[model samples]
Target: MDCNEYCELLPACADDELGAAESLRLEQHLAQCAACTAELGRLRALRAAVREGTTYHRASPALRARIAAALPAAAVPAAAVPAAAPASRPRWLEWFAWRPAANAGLAALTVASMAFGLTSFMLQDSPQDAMAREVVTSHVRALIADHAIDVVSTDRHTVKPWFNGRLEYAPPVHDMAAEGFPLVGGRLDYLNGQRVAVLVYRRNQHPIDVFVLRGAGSRKAAPDFDSTLTRQGYQITHWQAGGMDYWAVTDASAADLQRFSQAWRMASGGTP
Candidate 1:
């Protein structure tokens, strides 16, 4: 199968959810294609890291009790009333009986709880996923605007130093010319709620955007290759390595992107 086909099935392959025929086809392709092989390696490593890093915590008794208390009472206990009870109560008894102010307070608390849960889910990334999504979004935006970089240069030294005080950390920049991908330039962007440096590069006619940001938390033990196709036709691969989050996005074939990622891992002193 071609690279685009492979890219489409990669998430399934990584999750080992591919059907037999598809799995065989992908394996056969990997055997004959060095680039595909490299990509599979990166993806496998990323999946492992994500699995290892994911943590599940049970809610504390006190917290659970609070959540339960916030919910409207299901039914009033017999002990809460006299033997003789009113027969004209509304079908939706809880809503009808609740004080207006109490009902409003409960609605606000429910909304706040949902918002907190969503925010927590997004922040669960261990650098890799965060960086990858950032790069993907930036690339997609740049492609739509037809502007991918602020400063264009081939020299790593030139691009690296350009971010001097613009960012909190100096993003590691390298020229991969010998490997068929050349450094193009760099730009500044915001990702995961922080300002970041974006290093641009090219593989053949396609552009690859790499996002570099400060190590927000502890270093993840491996790369996280979260891939997704943008509405603008670019595929994004995001991960973390060497305590820095890196997200690379491009319209280049999946095999080419995988090759770039493998080369990047080697150049960065191995994944994680």
Candidate 2:
């Protein structure tokens, strides 16, 4: 199977949801493809880390008793008392015993509390946030390298055509030379198991690298923005537009990158 096809099944494969035949096909491909194997390792590690960090807690007996005591007296059952009960024992004390209504109320409260806690945990531990952090790291690593783009050309015509059959989707390639950000060149880069087109451009002296990948969801006209400063002292802005994820990495200030991104959106007919 090709890398694209293998990626679609990786999530299912990790969950062991694939049928025997499909699982075998993926296994065969993984045996030959080192990149996919590495990706699988990353995904598994991420899942393990998130799972290990999640927390679970049970309500204490004292807390449960307190909650039960606050309910209506009719909702509680009578506690058992011997015929020779202590003369000092109060009759009201017998009604503090647990009842079916109390149990059901406690169970409902426990479920609601657990659901809220789990939702909060997942929002903080989302995989998408982790993946975005990794993308920023990759961009930083590429910036420090002697060569960022595999192919370097000044012409958009030359750069755009280079990715013809290399990827499943046509990446948005535009010339913003008139608006101060000019197209420099392009390259082939792999992100999240798919081969993506990396287009290089410049805004004044700052170098902005736009990494484009396929598989963005149905809302293709809007650009999604994410910003991070890399360890190498470069700033990265990422977004998705036209069914593609765009990561714009540069050493320039955020305002400049924002301007460049706006121009790019207009050029590509995508909403700002």
Tens digits of per-residue lDDT for model 1, 144-260: 556678888999989999999887788898778999999989888655556678888899899888877656632432357544434246676656776786667788887788888
**Pick by TM-score: which candidate is best?**
2
How well does candidate 1 score on lDDT at residue 11?
A: 77
Every model's Cα RMSD, please?
15.7, 8.6
Error of 1 at 139 (Å): 1.6
Candidates in order, TM-scores: namely 0.49, 0.52
Report the Cα lDDT for candidate 1.
Answer: 0.69
Clashing pairs in 2: none
lDDT of 2 at 155: 82
TM value for model 2: 0.52
Deviation in Å, model 2, residue 166 alpha carbon: 1.9
Candidate 1 is scored at a TM of 0.49
